[model samples]
Target: MRSGRLSFSFTMLMIGIAFLYVPMLVLIGYSFNASPLVSVWGGFSVKWYGSLLHNRQLLDAALLSLEIALLSSTGAVILGLLAATALVRFRQFRGRLLLTGMINAPLVMPEIITGITQLLLFVSMAQMFGWPHRGLTTIVISHVVFCGAYAAVTIQSRLITVDRSLEEAARDLGSTPLRAFWDVTLPMIMPALASSWLLSFTLSLDDLVISSFVSGPSASTLPMVIYSKVKLGVTPEINALATLIIVAVGACVVFAGYTMRRAERQRDQEMQAAYRQPAG
Candidate 1:
């Protein structure tokens, strides 16, 4: 019966949600454990959070990770915007296919392969030029190159849906092409730009394999630190750190969603008001 099928589907949906969220819930629960050992359920305590604050190495690693995420996301967005503009607007240029393929290369390549290739490339450059030296700068460079590909893909998808006429109208009103793009096209794709930057930040923050290959011993990231700790064994401190990250990211997502909805509502109001106006 249709009713029976509907009931089964609802049960399956609930199962799917549980499958995805149960681990996160468990991790969150363990974050409050007073005991250091993750496996043992100790009474609730915020002791680990206090300890985490004074852990200099971990704090340094976290700060470095945040810096990389901010810088690399900014760099990736600029590079990606350029790539997206060229691909979408200058479709008939020579080597278009090659350029497009290169921009998308990271999406298809395995992390190990990408990491190794970048490592080798950096080594060759450093050997020849005596520069970069596989530290923070080198890590940022690798992240920019890798993250830019994703940014380009994200922006390009949004660009395809955008109306070219907006920019053209700006140009017709005596704006230069570049000015028109700055004033019109950029605003239209603001959502995509925000998305691209956020995604790039997440990718750079989450990266382990690529960062390991590119970063020096002195420039270990938060993920690198967590990974090393995990090798020894999970602890309440790590669980606490992870839970904090989850909370921070969730807060950011909520804020972004709210901003986007507000923008949409404002735009809708403006459009409706414009429609109500008498013809000039």
Candidate 2:
């Protein structure tokens, strides 16, 4: 009975993996087809990739997307770190639950609503302060708002897992609160910080709807470019671009996991060594 159950579970797991990977496999396969129509494979060719590289507009849009992702993710990490610290350290405060809920509300809210709200706010700000017209800055700001929520949640969970005694020990050893945080708490949460930053970056880079609503005519993102092209019709070029993005993101994920595992191993080794040392 146990063997039968294990086989069934294994089969189900394989089915789930196939379900997730089959579409991606199809996309990658079509990317190599020479035909303009993705459905029909004329022959294998690299022309689509070459064309993608030469498309100035697409390149510009990609650059803009990168810039926005970098700025928005960085801003989100900073804001999220502060919010997470506040949430964890100031647990006695009134409305803590309400504030936490507000911070995480974006995760559940509809993207269209968030987009519309950001659009209206940008318009209002521009009209009131005669601020710079909405474009990349506005899009970045909108992304940061949502991205920060995700980062905060990630960081907060990690913070809760950390031992409070570490910080207390640091403080008891004559470290100021700030020093204790930097020396003890921050180091402990470095992995969470790294993970949160990358998560925010990926989220911002992949965002389309909110960025579309907030961005002006001049600041088109990679997703916007892809969406416009997709509206006309699918092409091998798009498939090629999608495949490239998949490969790049996959590589990044693999590298991050490898680095994190290495760090954890080193940490474990250090702990072992310390335990083996003679006590003074």
Candidate 3:
């Protein structure tokens, strides 16, 4: 009976993997198709990939999206570090609950609601104080709002788990509070910071609804462009574009995982070596 149950579990696991990956596999295969029609797969060809360079609209949108992602992710990291530090370092403070709720609200709140609320807020602000004209500026701000929340949550989880005594020890030395955090605590949470920044970058890059709401008529993100194209019909070019994105994203995730793993192994080795050392 145990053997039977194990086989069933294995079957379920395979089924789950197939369910998740089979569509992406099919999409990748179709990306090489010569025919424009998505349903009809012609002989394999790389023409569509080459054609992406000529598509000015798609290229422009992609560039805009990249710019927004980079800017928003950087801003989000700064905001996340500040929020995470404040929450972790200051145990008791006035409006702490409110600050916590604001930080977490984006995680729980629906994207549509967030987008709509931001749109309304932007319209109101534009009317009152002629500032932050809609376009790339608004989109980046909108992205940073939600992306910062995610970054904060990711960093906060790591921050809370870190030992406070290390920073205290540094403080006991000549190191100031800022210096202690920079020298001691910062290294410990470097992984979390990297992870949060990547997450924020991915989120900002992938955002559609929020970008749509905040972006002006002139500003279009890559997702917005792809979505518009998909509305017409999925073509070979779209498939190729998607395949490229998947490959790029997959490479990044793999690289990040490998880097983090190596760093962890090195840390473990150092700890083991330290433990083996003789006492003074």
Q: What local distance difference test score does each model get?
A: 0.90, 0.89, 0.92
Using lDDT as the yardstick, the better of models 2 and 3 is 3
Best by lDDT: 3
**Using Cα atoms with residue i matched to residue i, what is each candidate's TM-score against the true structure?**
0.93, 0.93, 0.95
Best by TM-score: 3
Q: Write the per-residue lDDT of candidate 3 for residues 105-192, one digit (tens) a residue.
A: 9998988899988988998999999877999999999989899999999999999998898799899988999999999889989988
Worst 10 residues of 3 by lDDT: 267-276
User: How would you encode candidate 1's per-residue C-alpha lDDT over 164-279 as one tens digit per residue?
Assistant: 98789899999999999999889878988998898899899888999999887778999999999988887778888999998888788788878977886887698689879997
> Ten-residue segment with the worst summed lDDT in candidate 2?
33-42
List model 2 lDDT by residue over 209-275, tens digit each: 9988998877889999999998988777889999999889888988997998789689779868977
Model 3 / residue 265 / CA error / Å: 1.7
- Report the CA-based lDDT of candidate 1 relative to the real structure: 0.90
Measured by TM-score, how close is model 1 to the native structure?
A: 0.93
Candidate 3 at residue 203, lDDT? Answer: 93
